[model samples]
Target: MPADDSPTGLSQPLYLCVADELGQLIAQGQLAAGERLPSVRELSQRRGLSPTTALAALRALEQRGWVEARPQSGYYVRPKLRRLAEPATSRPPSAARPVTVGSIAARLLAASNEPGIIGFGAAIPEADWYPVATLQRLASQAARRHRLLIGEYSPFFGLPALRHQIARRYAELGIAVDDDEVVITNGCMEAINLALRTVAAPGAVIAVESPTYYGLLQLIEAQGMQALEIPTHARDGLSVEALATALTGPQGAQIRACVVTPAFCNPIGALMPEAAREALVALCRQHRIALIEDDVYGELDFAGQRPLPARYWDRSGNVLLCGSFSKSLAPGARIGWLLAGRHRDAVRMRKFTTSAGTALVYQHALSAYLETQAYPRHLVRLRRLCATNVARYIEAIERYFPAGTRVTRPSGGFVVWVELPRGTDTLALYERALFRRINFAPGPLFSASGRYRNCLRLNAGRQWTPDVDGALQALGRLVEAG
Candidate 1:
């Protein structure tokens, strides 16, 4: 029962070590399903540990689906259940097609935030998930203390204090980020936009995931660039081999940059393996293509360890790391930052000339909040909540969705990608779902070539409730009918 006792004890806590060992045994078939686990005291005695440690390990196992608790009967390996299939790796066309999507896409998004809609459509974390009350109080305090600076413009790179905090957080993630080089923007999208405009020209080609965030595709389309879709896995993220192939193909020479989420990519919620990240950086460095990383979802990891960003391997400054509080902290704060390795000066200049700067009040408020609560501490609790929500959503999907429906299980983030049975048209379902007052992202919107006709993405950012549960059940019926 020592204070040092952790769950699993693998990495995050001592209990994780215990949970990991048990999970491995179960996966290896050594601990057969339905077999009984040791009693808390027996586990402690057998493993030369304390009772608390044993109990904690068992609890971690239960949380991760390795075991189940049966009241006074002790823990038992959970019965193996047939889960929904995962989506297959994407194989988008190799040609780099010019962006043609326009304002209609914008009009569809315009009604996304409308009230009275049961929203599972947007990628944003629900307002109920954030520490909004605390943020509002902090904003009020910042406004009172810096009343004179209320209407003042933030520095060209944002408030020094906020930049300092952002830099500190990046350092924790193993990026040697320079605060001076960081350019703050309206949000992650703006940071990405600025980085894109800074590196590639309007007509240049950019390599992107076959199925990526709609916002990213929209940006590519809005910038008048051509998109060379690279094959991507539903769980493993962008394929480096595919990207290399694209880089060497007839259209490869036209590709100036490769934009990716790297960690929990939107729509698919995929994370590139550490080795893949290194390779991606090397590929970009060798080919002289810029690596634009969208790290907004980086902090939402369900696993305790945050994936190392592609920015960590950028030795030649070919990487542009974009981050924001929109995904992790305040949604409306609109505070985003970018670290452009060699293009720092140009990005800063471009951003300055275009937008001047972000609001000082929010900058100061965020800086103060981060200083007081150290983002890491908040993330720990947030991650645990998100993990639980993801589990609930997955349970609902497995129980209610059609038998042939496939889904994604991400290591981090709150979004899940669903691939319906072949010939199922989600666009038609989108209309029906809307009519029924349930909102979810239709698959076609996530692509430029209008692919993913039967795919859909759902947001699990909101806490599970009875109403949501009913909505999911109803959606299941809707999908079945489709």
Candidate 2:
């Protein structure tokens, strides 16, 4: 390892400094794969540090996947091909493509829900993350105290109390939406569906992030609208330049709406920088294209401060922002809310035609829950846990996956995008993993044109236990062998 010359008066802890030194050595090829790494005892003795600090440093590297510990054999440099690089920013064909969401997602979704598998497929938080006991208590309270609410159907705009709470949350994100402008839906899916239907019609083109949430593409396909996928980057999301080019081109007039997840987008977990977000909103406004913002994962940022959604940049109210408590709160509550802005009447009518309104029971429950400080407290814990899991998962992937397997470094949310060696078929790997009782989201599912055949998305939403780690390691082995 490089000499740990602790830079003069740094804020980083000693163990972290050690970890950084070791990481540098590995990256610089000073330490070769499969070679035995320094033991905790050696690290302590050589660095002249306490054993605890040395162990912690080694463990940090372990979590980052620099080295792996063998039960009795000590630590060794993990063997990897290191030949592949992270997937480049996507560049989908310019023209619109008719949606053809295959039947593959059905099988994967089914597998994700079924027992007997170590799941890394579904973008759901760990079960423990939800305040189940609290929700149960609230549910009973809501049933007893709000009997009248259940007896009558919810108002077209949804329960005023829930809308107010949803609006307050939006206010925190810098969108000053009135409670009356909010419409409650069964989940984020429904909110997005309503937004798509309101701004677009059959055969119209809807622009989306190239490798976006599969569910979004599924929604567009179900509505019979074509998709024009805009190129997006893994770290910074949705390319405003490409979008501008697409919107001003001859085919721009056909585009009815643009759907985007500016905060921790699914599959890739990319965040759109503030400038890009502003540019996108302005572009949409200039082109008169309606913008639908998915902020479902907005508040789960590890940094705690929420990123401003495109709605914050909207002056004409053309941006409809969608948020759901499903990922952060109880999924069973099925509580999602939308601020439709100018399209309020259209969304209100669609809500009536579809499920009428979000269930009063769920609305009341979530509303009551949000009134307490528990929601924010739960979010803090959930974010910390998810971040740690992501770090540990990255380490595991480094230790076990082949070299050249590029993975996303997400700042928030619990999904990581991994690009494997070229020609490595993730669909085939999916089948092999299912046979081994492991499930992960294959890359092709997220695209309209079936790209990313060598990529896969791993869910870090689950608690990082031995079983989860084992399954991830097995997945790496499978990719390497293939």
Candidate 3:
């Protein structure tokens, strides 16, 4: 076969083109489950391709759930696993309520890095998964080259080079953002906080997805604001129709801002369709409410396409976009960015008052890394690993969890929202799991109104180990005992 012989006639990577052909055979039942696939050399010879390309195709198939690799053996077609039922669309109360989050989330974060603990609590990935050594080397080189700048603070909007890199990334996603419009933030949280401060005030009503990220709830609580919960789907994301209805209700006019994670939202892992995203942007514009998008997980889509942020649909500069490398790259770097659109100045001032400026060394190092065009390559590996891990986690949950448990089938990101049998009281279950060195985020922490008592969220970002499986079994047994 010629190098350009993609069945789809598109200019995709050669490995993906080959993987698609193999995947089609699997889908058509030509490649039966449990059947061993051709060896790398055999495949290469058969396809008139190189061994490296053939191996890459097999790995791609493995990542896509079409095949599996065995130790010391070639790949085999993966058997279809039973799919778990997904959690239903959330139905939070229609009225706006005061944010009253508790210390559970903080406690979880505090214990996240503890040794001997199985971390299913935090969405953080293992450090080894990151290009840590490469970053360290880059940082050292930056320090040597710019030793005098070490004593100086980063610009309030961050290093111009880093801002340019961030803007270039957004441009790749078809979002036209000037580098000057981007603010370097400590992390996505600070970017969001700055957005909230710029748009809403104390006691203001903020529209949020029901069962949103716990950190967002904490942010609202810290600001003494009220949360107007909007029902969100398990898969499709925040209900645009529901949000529109709420916006026109008695509480609608008072809502100062709408915060959404249109791409793989935390816990529930919802990916809003493009139509919904466009509608959301338009609705916020009509209501004159700020659309603050937390797009930290936007680039982690397993489908190989980086999902566009809601900010992509902004026509009048009403969207405030927040993203971070914490999820995709080095979390310890504390690097994130914000595009505040028309609110850029206010956000910059807020960022200045909040943290003065982000660290410059990491920004310089990251900028250098981006210049090498390595970030995209890094994401390809990370996304593939995350997709495999997510599949493993969901399969384990289905096999080990209680009979009535339902989990989210996230197409992106590395977390899943699990709904246990009614009255399971996951908070109680969480405490029990904690005693066994197991940790998972209980459902109530994801909401301000103390909802989802029978729910929990598990982290698929962690490296899978025998200990993890044991912990899952232990958790299942504990639930059964209760």
Clashing residue pairs in all predictions, respectively, total 16, 5, 0
lDDT of 1 by residue, 1-482 (tens): 11111222112455655665566567445788899998999989988888898999999778656689998899999876657889889988878887654553564576576777778888876674566666777788888998677566557778998998889988987778878987888999999999999999988999999798878888888899988888999888999999998898898788999999999999898999989999999999999999999999988888778888899988899999998999887889999999999999899898988899888888887888888654666677567656666766776787788889999988789998889888889888888888888888888887878899999888888655567878898999999987
The residue-by-residue lDDT of candidate 2 on 264-333, one tens digit each, is 9998889999999999989999999999999999888877887888889889998998988888877888
The alpha-carbon lDDT assigned to residue 136 of candidate 1 equals 76
Residue pairs with backbone overlap in model 3: none
**TM-score: which candidate is best?**
3
After superposition, candidate 3 runs with Cα above 4 Å error: 1-81
Per-candidate TM vs. native?
Answer: 0.85, 0.85, 0.87
Per-model C-alpha lDDT, please?
A: 0.82, 0.83, 0.86
Candidate 1, position 472, lDDT: 90
lDDT of 3 by residue, 1-482 (tens): 11112232233477766775676566445788999999999999999999999999999788656688999988999886655689889999999988877588778887776888998998888776677778888898898999766787668789999999999988987889998998999999999999999999999999999889999999999999999989999999999999999989999888999999999999799999999999999999998999999999988998799888888889899999999999998899999998999998888889889999988889988898888766877787678767767766776787678788899989899998889888799888887888899999999998878999999899988866667868888988887777
Candidate 2: clashing pairs of residues:
65-395, 81-403, 82-403, 82-404, 84-404
Q: Give the TM-score ranking, best first.
A: 3, 1, 2
Better of 2 and 3 by lDDT: 3
- Model 3 / residue 57 / CA error / Å: 16
